[model samples]
Target: MAATIDELIALVEQNRDAVVGDLFPVREAAPRLIEASVYHPVICLILQGSKETTSHAGSVRLGRGDMLVVSHDTPVTARITGVPYLALILPIDLERVRTLEQSLTSADAGQAASVLQATVAGSAILETLARLLAIRPKTPEDSVLTPLLLTELHFHLLRSPAGAMLRRLVSPSSHESRIARVAALIRRDYARVHRLADLAREAGMGQSAFHHHFKAVTGTTPLQFQKDIRLSEALRLLEQGAVSVTEAGLSVGYESPAQFSRDFSRRFGRPPRRVLQGIAAE
Candidate 1:
């Protein structure tokens, strides 16, 4: 089997923006700034170069041989700082994790901290990843192999040093899981009006506790979380030329054009009109 980093670098070199099997993405790019956006639960392993993620929780820099586990949907700014940055992104399957949580003993309940964190991955995790990367599917039967390997991959993550934190993240009754459910709700319904009270109820917590745990889990208030999702969607729509500035804003729950413009400008560091103009010029 090819070395883990070597295989990942080859994949990225072949298709820098390729999404391999909807489970992970191979990104190869030059150093650049990435705008703030809501990142879903995922594990990022940097194979080459480095990057930084900045959120309300703080800034964290990760490089080769390091792993980052993001437990919830969080809005943050990221920057790639390598000549040709290559990273592997594995989206966490919460349902699968929840199922696995049943097998974990009380000893697995480790301290929990939300946000992107740097941790060392064990050899078992690396070996499993290497085996996963080496797979070459040439038949229908081979297709099933990938899912099995993915399940194995998740298993390794559940037993790694960060496993306890991950366990807390997926446990149905944990505060982190409650907050994550609320975040998922915001992501799914960002274009609709959401009240803090309603969201707190959904999380099975009182308003004050919900607010505290929401911020603790996501590093942002419930309202800001919704706003981030909306603005992120609006930016995406504008970038794709799918809608006019006003349409984009209004489509993402913005009723007042003026308020949308101001918020868009503040978040993206540029107004929608100007961003559109630049895109057109390109």
Candidate 2:
């Protein structure tokens, strides 16, 4: 296993551009904190060092061979724990998962419910990841090989121990799947006005049920989810030096600058101005 990961690390270093597009390599030579963001569904394979990730659901520490499978959109803060951290981040396509779900046999259909977002990766997953990293993208072979490998990877994930989480989120009738739909809407139209009643209807649940289930699945309320999304965007803009504090707030759907500032300070432990000042100093 160590030998395989060593080879993978070399491949990742060589193919740092990830021409395949969906496969992304993350490497950090020093420990650092990753700012909060709304994380979408993805699989993160930790190949070296460790990281501690905190979300509303709580925190989990992942080391080598740990696979973090996030099934829903979540607000997350992460710190790379060990030196020379290296990992692969594969963003899952729910559309493809849905298509794959249609092919599951009856024996494979009885996946148990799981609320966990992280798990120890199996040998099969590691081997598959190594194969994925071996592909050289943008070549004729890549054109034919990437798709097949991705399908194989996703299929392996669907049958892995964490498969339950993925299955529940993709199952059409599951509450988690319903809430995911509403969450997707919020993510897309975050800058627009939204009503809880409408969101509930969209999820096909009563207001109270929707509220409960939404929180259960996402670890945050719908309104708060929107707020997090708004603040995350504002932070990004501020970091880019693209907008002033007030403009950053307004651009992300905050009508009141003071409210935006307060929210930003509360979530990020600093005002938007600090981010601007830091960017300018750079």
Candidate 3:
């Protein structure tokens, strides 16, 4: 296991600034002070050193041998706690999860949060991940084999102790899944004004029930969730220098420049210009 980890680390270091296949680069020199946008569901395994994640739901610190499961798109503040942090990021395969859901009995279903932290990972899971890292997909057959390996990895996770939370994510009838659908809608059209009633209708729930269940699953109300997504996109625009601050605000559905600035400052701990300035300096 130690040797496999070492091999994985070496592969990550060699591609420190680039993603190798589906693996996100794992290089950070300092603890990031600003929240980075996490726009999808993924499983992150800490292979070396440690890191921390803070969202509205709560905060979690993950060290070597720990894994984190994020079940939706959410804004999270993350920073490395140990120098030279190394981690493996795997995107969740919704199709594979849905397939696994069909085989789950009623007894396998349970309510679980969108975010989970686990100290243990199955050895088989780790070995399979290592194999994925080692394989170079240069041919069509290799590419075909990659998804199969990823499916196998998902199967291992579904049977692990952490499977319950994952099961809830894929169960079409589960409240968590319903909330996920709404969250996806919010992400897809965050720039548009969303009516609570309409969103509730789409989720097949009453307004009050949708409000309660959305908050329970996501740790924030629908409006707050939309605002977060909007601000995150606006921040990205500002960083990219693609638009002026006013334009960025307007593009993301904020009509009032003053209101946008206030919300942006409150969320990011600085005004938009200053944040952009800092990024430029970096």
Candidate 4:
């Protein structure tokens, strides 16, 4: 089991742009897990059994050979329902997304890539990804040899049955692509006072269309997304011991320090000050 876990870690390291490590080998039967929330995007790929994730909007389940992509910054509750269920989670940085986007766009596939991107994805893409992720690459790996794995994943998507859904992510002309761009802006400057009209303008869509398109892609309203970014940033700042509660709150676009405190407490189950103190006192 340890060897298998180690190998899987190595594979993820080779394929990942950036990731956070909190890995272990364990078996459990529903022992009250803590809520998980992150400031960036994470992909949870389940290898055995299943896990259910609940956001403010709705819940999603990822069974074996299935994955869930959390693209927004938000607080979420996760519960392990299936017995002895396990998953491999990888945090995908925006830099990685940009790299893939550029690679696909610059390729000379021309109309073939366009047709793939326009079609909705089916199960072929998921199956190929699942098989690749199941590998545990053990031994001295080439650091600069990652392009093949990345490109293979691209090709798999281009040819998969679910290729359309996967291709939706790459369509620079599609609504999904525009919303993705908006998401990138918010991620880069989460502290900005984001107005719906401003986001609509940036998305190059009308106000109503922007709202509809944004929610269609991210499954949340604009205000909810912003609030999530603020909270996630506040958590990271406190965790890193770089700022005081007041400073963290304001830096993440919180105007009223009191309101920030309240929201932080509500989302995190503790006030920012107390959480910082706990983290420091540890």
Candidate 5:
């Protein structure tokens, strides 16, 4: 008796995000195609085969025993590659991370390496999260087991090799860490104009280092990251009934509406007006 893909899907269905509960699962693959919308704080692990995520930051490659953790709300074009690309995904809540970060004290943490990428692999954590994903919703009988398991997961992370990689990941220090702070700022205020000089100064690093570290941390240039953020936010606004593409662009710091249209079209596969029109018709 082995776990099947249908069982995994049923387990996933039981732990809906609407219930604010995380899901754990082992998924089987279909050879034709598999893709998904960008998600938030996803811990994706390939237990058997492989998958690729196409993001503004570029493609993230994961394979057997390999994992990738995205700590933010990311926009990506993703597809599973190869046959039998079995995998596991765990959705973490932002508030949960915030709470864990507050409790952990690795005061001597260092700046990320010069080639730091947002993606990192932690086999130990992957094993635990993957096993959790294989299980579904629990009853009062297992209430004690759930918190105990989650607590162990949190502590084990602080003790793992992944924890060693984060000297300043949880705090602000050095060029790379500060620029990560700036990335957080952009996510919060993607609609505002951001000056490089201002960001560099705020990061407490030289402009050149700021640029270098920003690229290293995010795997994308600053302007490109901001542009992606702006466009993503604008689309969210449009879907919320912003009414005018020009208004959305202007709000997100695009002084030229036509330029906004071109960039937005390139990123989103269609111009704003037509995209919204299609959405409205839907």
Candidate 6:
């Protein structure tokens, strides 16, 4: 297993410009605090070092041989706790997973209450990823064989225990799927005001049931989730120096600048003005 991982790591390092569309290689040589960013559905495999990511769903640490599965769009703060971090991030295609799920038999029922799960990567998944990384981009193998390998990869994932999150996400009748849909909607139009009742109706649940399942899956309430999205976007705007603190606040749906400052400070541990100033100094 170690040899396979080492070879895969070398392949990623050698093929930095390879155009495998869904496979992204990450090699961070130094530990640093990665700012808040939205994490879409993906499987992240750590080939070397370790890191911790905290989102509304809580903090999780992953190291070598570990696989992290995220089933929704989560805004998170990530910190590299170990140097020479190397990983492969493969974005999941929901439509593909859904289509595959309908054909596979007795897929793991999955822990339907959580949006994030971490476990050791199975030998099958690791080897499949190695084959995927070995493909030369812009070649016939990449075009003809990439899709087949990805399907095989997804099949192995569906058959594994760690795949429970992916399984639950693709199950249209599952409560987690309903809440996931709502969460994706919130992320898309985060700048607009959303009513709890409207969100509940959209999820096909009563307000109380929707709220309960939402918090259970997301580790935060619906309104707080929206606020997380708003503040994350505000930080991006301030960091880019394209807007004033006040403008950033209003642009992301804050009615009052003071409230935005307070929320931004609470979320990121710095005032919006301070972020803007730091960007200007740079």
TM for candidate 6 is 0.95
Pairs of residues at least 3 apart in sequence or in different chains that clash in candidate 2 = none
Which stretches of candidate 3 lie above 4 Å from their native place? 1-4, 11-21, 279-282
User: Candidate 6, clashing residue pairs?
Assistant: none
Candidate 6 per-residue C-alpha lDDT over 18-87 given as tens digits, one digit per residue, 9 for 90 to 100 = 6585888788889999776888888899989999988877788999988888888888888999978988
RMSD of 3: 2.5
Task: Give the candidates in order of lDDT, highest first.
Answer: 6, 2, 3, 1, 5, 4
**Decreasing TM-score order of the candidates:** 6, 2, 3, 1, 5, 4
Candidate 1 to native Cα RMSD, angstroms = 2.6
Model 3: what TM-score? 0.90
TM-score of each: 0.89, 0.92, 0.90, 0.65, 0.66, 0.95
Task: Judging by lDDT, tell me the better candidate of 2 and 5.
Answer: 2
List ranges where model 4 is wrong by over 4 Å. Answer: 1-36, 39-43, 48-50, 70-86, 89-145, 157-164, 280-282
* Model 1 CA lDDT for position 19: 48
Expressed as tens digits, the lDDT of each residue in 179-203 for candidate 5 is 6567777767766778898888888
Q: What overall lDDT goes with each candidate model? A: 0.76, 0.82, 0.77, 0.60, 0.61, 0.85
* Residue range 37-115, candidate 1, lDDT tens digits: 6788888888888888887767888888678887777777888887556667888877778777666665356565556
- Candidate 4 local lDDT, 35-146, one digit each (tens): 5354245545555565667765467665655556555444566667776565565444434454466555534333321110112223544443434544344423323334
Q: Choose 5 or 6, whichever is better by TM-score.
A: 6
- Could you tell which candidate, 3 or 6, scores higher by TM-score? 6
Candidate 3 colliding pairs, count:
0
Candidate 1's error at 4, in angstroms?
5.1
Clashes of each: 0, 0, 0, 9, 4, 0
The Cα error of candidate 1 at residue 225, in Å, is 0.9
